[model samples]
Target: MSKALSKRFGEESMDRIITWLEMQKISKDVALLDIGTGNGVFLIELAKSGFTNLTGIDNSSTAVELAKAIAEKEEVMSLKLQVADFLHPFPKLSQYDICIDKGTFDAISLSPDHPAEKRSLYQQSLHSVLKEGGMFLITSCNWTKEELVNHFSEGFEMLQELPTPKFQFGGKIGNSVTALVFRRK
Candidate 1:
């Protein structure tokens, strides 16, 4: 997962997304969850930026262990790393102010298995752990702006669309990766 993530999302892509998140002025008191947070890279960055309440969950046990090690080495005292699957039910008390997914959605969508059912459950799980009006930030290379917005229309309101600046063949505007925020309603 870590290697795949690194290959899919470059430093520049992460920098842009982080910059946009910083612009949101998220309060330190608010809970933040990073779904599929492999190695806690984004959580470490958030910790460095003074966000104290952070949680990262990944389905892979190895990824969770790596994230824990990274968090400890970086002295991210407030981060809680867990091994959990988004397709299953989360605890009732697990509510968050914000939830982020960098590439998990794309992976689920591209998998050969029951992608639609798993995707639906994943969205529901996100909503279950997110407070009303809480934000869900997703960065995906598999979905376009319209596809994502439409896909999330059932339970979330599209808040914003952020596109990566990579220029494809003929100087076209859009890139493989697209970033978007949706507010739970």
Candidate 2:
């Protein structure tokens, strides 16, 4: 599964995230939330890296169940996996020190059911769940860095833009993915 994830989302992406966490001196026990955690591979990797307090939430119940099963098979007992929509506030969950989104924002942006409204709700819900001054690391394929910064400008300030693979197309240089780290205001 890890190998498959590495193939789907380059292994370097996960390495970069772990590296950034270490460079920022984020504690292993800090409350961390993985938004739209598909199969929980990322959380499992974090667990392997020694992050103890981790929670992963996905909108799909089946995804949550798969994550739970994978975590169990991997002997990762510390992960808390649940099915919850990121467009809504999670009343039962505590505010997290860090939140990571790989493709949730992009998916919401592409939804045909009131995309603009859903995007707004996503921001509100994310703000509610993430602590002030907390970190949000997001990786997106649909939006450029500037677009992402603009979308999150309301309550998040750009901290750093992580490196991703680039290509030349139509006499222009573009990145296949944009990974940005933002700090909640």
Candidate 3:
């Protein structure tokens, strides 16, 4: 599944993210956090793009270990991978300059019970970890741009909508994947 997703969304999705980062003119010294850093692919891409201050976290121990190994293999000296649950706030750490989510919310929302219970928690945690005016980027297959904007309406201003590959859907431009960036207020 990881390999398949990497092949499908790796280049195009990452290019969109890179473009957003460039537009923001985020310096290499600014802290970055990657929620649900599965296999650390996105962080690796950012690292390759000259992002120096990078950190990633996931609840899965296996994933954290894999991400650590991959980071080492890719020689990302400044990247840190840790095992963490995003639903809980991190009191020991400071706010980040940027926080990114790629399919993390989709996985959390897939829970059979109390799916939305954690959504609020995650939002609160994001608020806690992200500095004022900091950016949050999210990419998902489960939500449309409007849905995502509505979901994070409070304390955020929608900034940019990344382009997605549209297919013929009732004579409209429809896509399976959507990406958006928002700034905290």
Candidate 4:
């Protein structure tokens, strides 16, 4: 499980999120949502870490099915996995206290079909599903910290920026990925 998560989402990514959760003193019983949960590995990890109320959603039915299978195989069947598009109105689910997104915003930003509209809709959908003052943690390889802040500035405020690997190129150092936590306003 660790190897699969490390290969798909760098080990550091998950570690940093867990660290932040601890730093924030988030309760294990908080209603947490995993946005764009691909295979449900992260949800399983959260379950193993003692998070009780876990829900994951992906636009692809196949991905949701895969997540369900993986969760069952790992004996973490308490998770709620469903197919829901973030750019559209989400299905009726309870508002979450915390939401995590890994690479979903990056994919939406790259969409050629009305990228601006999709991005706006994504924010709206997220806002609709997350409670006021809810925390949103996102990890992206396609955008810088500054870019992400600018994108989500309207209804969200930056809380913390997680450290990522840096590379030096032409005497300039930059991060390969940006992980940010925001609070819904």
My TM-score estimates for the predictions, one after another, are 0.90, 0.94, 0.93, 0.93
Regions more than 4 Å wrong, model 4 = 1-8
lDDT of 4 by residue, 161-183 (tens): 98888889999999877899999
Question: Taking the tens digit of each residue's C-alpha lDDT, what string does model 1 give over 89-144?
Answer: 56832679898888888888888999998889888888798899999999887888
Tell me how candidate 3 scores on lDDT: 0.86
Cα lDDT listed for each candidate? 0.82, 0.90, 0.86, 0.88
- Among these predictions, the greatest lDDT belongs to 2
Instruction: Supply the TM-score for candidate 3.
Output: 0.93
Clash pairs for candidate 3: none
Q: After superposition, how far is residue 103 of candidate 1 from its true place, in Å?
A: 0.1
Q: Can you write out model 3's per-residue Cα lDDT over 1-185, one digit (the tens) per residue?
A: 47886567756777888887887787977899999988898898899988988889999999989988888888886788888889885674458989999888988888887988888777888889999999999988888999989989998999988888777778787887899999999
Tell me the deviation in Å of residue 64 in model 4: 0.7
- 2 or 3: which has the higher TM-score? 2
Clashes of each: 0, 0, 0, 0
After superposing candidate 2 on the true structure, give the runs of residues whose Cα lies further than 4 Å from its correct spot: 1-6
Q: Rank the candidates by TM-score, best first.
A: 2, 4, 3, 1
lDDT of 3 at 19: 83
For candidate 2, what's the RMSD? 2.4
Those runs of model 3 whose alpha carbons end farther than 4 Å from true positions after fitting are 1-6
